[model samples]
Target: MAEERSKVAAIGTFASAADHAECRRLHRRYGTTYYFATQRFPAAIRRRVHALYGFVRVPDEWVDNPAHTNKDAQSRALSDYRAQLLRGLEGVRPEEPALRAFCDVVHEVRMPLEEPLLFLDAMQMDLTVDRYETYRDLRGYMRGSASAVGLMMCAALEAGDDPEMLAAAQALGEAMQLTNFLRDVAEDAARGRIYLPQEDLRSFGVTEDEIFSGVISDRFCNLMKFEIARARALYALADIGIPMLPPCAQKAVQLARVLYSRI
Candidate 1:
């Protein structure tokens, strides 16, 4: 009994160390802005944040990678990732260190499984959908891809279940996602993806051809400005929830919001 217990303890320690290291590596490589913001968090919270980032980064890469030109292949890969994530969430440690670490954090924080599941649903959409017909349509995607992430963060921060706070977090997530879409217009175009709402494009008289051709016409500029204004509005809403977080977590969240808005 003693020897078996010792073996189990050793495995736990090794897994914990490996998991943290993997999360750190993923965060450093893929999320410079977010990783920088995490530095302000208390040590325990920082590590958990890293784990969450790492968990999300894996499927994001699979979906976004230029080499995965085959939509069916991307779909299959995302499905596999979802399966592994679900297993991890259920307390079955996945082979991947990042997944394992994320599982540990989820279990530790008692995060709802539905949050990550919703994120996977968004990734699945990426496989089949390219353009959003309207802002409302885009919001549906964001609910899974972005808002779910915010809720997950709230769970990690132990911010309690306040309806207003969750709504603010959702707004913040949408704002950040919109900021990224604006900044990555060229990059996303190269990937044959357009995150901008089709309705907005039509309203601004910016054609898909203009976007694909990298034309920064006056119309395109106006469109971008409009989107930025919307994102800023969301950021304002998000700002209200910052003070609602525990004092120790408030600074990190504030820094992240400011930095993302700047981008």
Candidate 2:
């Protein structure tokens, strides 16, 4: 029966039906725009992508809105998660299904462990660093958070070895991240975080008070326009790598790029 075949397919190499299902759920709930683009991918690739999203989202959540009020407790919990991820990468089966599935994808794609570690480092930084003095400073953080994730995705797509592809992927990731910072400015400000670089704020004559107070001044509008244009430039740079991807996978990536850029 079709149902039986589907059930059999659900038992992943490193995870179970429920595990992959959980990953899918997280991706759909939190990354709705991305989820739409992912649906265009082949089923196998979609599953792997979902697992990757879930793996990163867990740590991001811990740092962003932790259940524990104590900073030390939050740090310890993040460290524990990182340790488990390392163990999984070392061929030890993780007890958590998200880790299990993500590790399986890493092995299947021959992805390096360095990318995930870098991502964990970024999460740790979020605990202590809330504001960036310059775009370069923010970029340093994004190297571990956004660019590393793009590199991981490149590996997953079997295009990691190409330098050009990696460059473009990195640009794409940063562009998306910048978009997120711009969109979440108020929300992040409320949480005592400000992702926009201080230099840009100064250059545009926008102050933290205006941002925190939700004051949409002409200066703020100009600042946002400037940042939006910058994001679009990065998207343009990323476009160069699309043709390098396999024909079967190109459309999905393109769709994601288009949708995210629109946002």
Candidate 3:
């Protein structure tokens, strides 16, 4: 029984040991890259990170999987999941292991409830908005999906309300998310989602068909180059904030930044 508890120390009893165990399993199975970086964290922080990842990942899988039941079913699943999280945040124990574990961390760190809500809103957006017409449009989506998660992490790490740190964390989150979009362009395209901005494609003389057809035209290469450069710039911005984290946390976040930037 004790072996099934969280690997992180200082995890009291807000969530049952089984809840954290399930959260940890979700993180390890689906969040391979983030899970790699998480190992560098102090145990206390690592488990909370797992809980957070599990929380976001569950709703994401509900909507993202190509074989998902249907749009309405996915939407209903997300809504129901959000309701459970809301109850959990209000101090009622949730039946879902992921929500219960994440709520435990939220209460422990005094994280603002708004961040998770924003994340859920972004997930909701995924149901209806599959293609972004412009970089600005994509940024609007990312503000909730990526930036909010960064802000939540900043709170968890106790960055002490520093605007610079907050900005850097958001930049890092955006950078990582952009990297994922780049790496998964083919997969997301297969799912009928196009995260790359339409304007960028037009500017580079690439077309939706070219992306869908998986062509490696010079224009497509140029467009990818431009986006990769933009992602790197965000990573550079994130570097400025790493030093602001608690001493024990700096290494882990820096490693994550470095790993994602390499992609």
Give the better candidate number (1 or 2) by lDDT.
1
- Over the stretch 202-232, how does candidate 2's per-residue lDDT look in tens digits? 9999999998999999999999999999999
Q: What residue pairs clash in candidate 3, if any at all?
A: none
Question: Tens digits of per-residue lDDT for model 3 on 75-164?
Answer: 998889878876665556677888888888877887777778889989999999989999999999999899999988887677778999
Q: Give the TM-score of candidate 1.
A: 0.93
Q: How well does each candidate superpose onto the true structure, as a TM-score?
A: 0.93, 0.93, 0.93
The window of 10 residues in a row where model 3 has the poorest summed lDDT is 1-10
Cα error, residue 139 of model 2, in Å, equals 0.4
lDDT of 2: 0.85
How does each model score on lDDT? 0.86, 0.85, 0.86
Residue 108 of model 1, lDDT score: 73
RMSD of 2: 7.1
Positional deviation of residue 9's Cα in model 2 after best superposition, in angstroms? 22
Cα shift from native, residue 104, model 1 (Å): 0.5
